[model samples]
Target: AQSVAQPEDQVNVAEGNPLTVKCTYSVSGNPYLFWYVQYPNRGLQFLLKYITGDNLVKGSYGFEAEFNKSQTSFHLKKPSALVSDSALYFCAAVDNYGQNFVFGPGTRLSVLP
Candidate 1:
């Protein structure tokens, strides 16, 4: 079985400050990791993904994540956060086998002015 975890239930950041949301995973082999953001009453929106090549993967909304094989972690990061960035973030993983897609509980990000 493959699983993902977002240790923080919520993350608070000041507008224009750098922000990060932690994520760790467990899987049999190399896993395909993903990050998604959900706004109020909206479906999850794709943020970024790590499949094979590069360790650092960049995605929409000025978001990026680094795939750390040693730590089994893929934490989402942004150089500067905005109040509009406030939303629920989720980390997900699919094993190399591609049999299952598991999602983290989700971490709420609040960017204050």
Candidate 2:
């Protein structure tokens, strides 16, 4: 079965500090990974995706991720986190044989000022 797991309920970070929300996925074949962010009462906004090639993928809000095949993990990262970065983060995966995607419950990133 294809699934995405976000082990953390939330990540607390101070302004200008680095922050990370954990994510791991499982699929039958190759993985098409994506990240999204959501603000209060707003639709989710796309961040990045890992389809093929380089494991290091960058996205909006100065975010990036490293796709690891062996571990089946795609962890989002940032050099420095901003207070505005506080929001809900979700990791998603497209089914190898199915077009629909599976999403993690979501990790709330709290970037304190």
Candidate 3:
């Protein structure tokens, strides 16, 4: 079985400050981790992914993620946050079979100016 979790239901950050959204996963075999963001009434937008190679993976919108195999964690980070960055963040992981993709409950990020 594969599952993903976002312990924080909401994250608040000041503009231009660093931000992080934590994510953890439990899966068999090598996990394919991904992060996505969703705006109001908008679909999920791809942010970053971790498949292999480097533990750190950079993605769109100046966002990056660090994959920790030992901890089974893939946390999303940004050097500086923006008001427009406020949205719903989701963490997902693909199962070993790659047929099922488990998604987290989601975390709402609020970037205040």
**Each prediction's whole-model lDDT (CA):** 0.96, 0.91, 0.96
Q: Candidate 3 overall Cα lDDT vs. reference? A: 0.96
Residues 1-113, candidate 3: write the lDDT tens digits. 67899999999999999999999999889999999999999999999999999999999999999999999999999999999999999999996578678999999999999
Please tell me which model should have the higher lDDT, number 1 or number 2: 1
Steric clash pairs (candidate 2)? none
Better of 1 and 3 by TM-score: 1
Off by over 4 Å in 1: none
Candidate 2 lDDT tens digits, 31-95: 89999999999999999999999999999979999999999999999989998898999999996
Worst 10 residues of 3 by lDDT: 93-102
For model 2, the superposed segments whose C-alpha errors exceed 4 Å read none
Candidate 1 residue pairs that clash: none
State TM-scores per candidate: 0.98, 0.95, 0.97
TM-score: the better of candidates 1 and 2: 1
Worst lDDT run of 10 residues, candidate 2, spans 93-102
lDDT value, residue 71 of candidate 1: 98
User: What is candidate 1's lDDT per residue for 64-101, written digit by digit as tens?
Assistant: 99999999999999999999999999999999888789
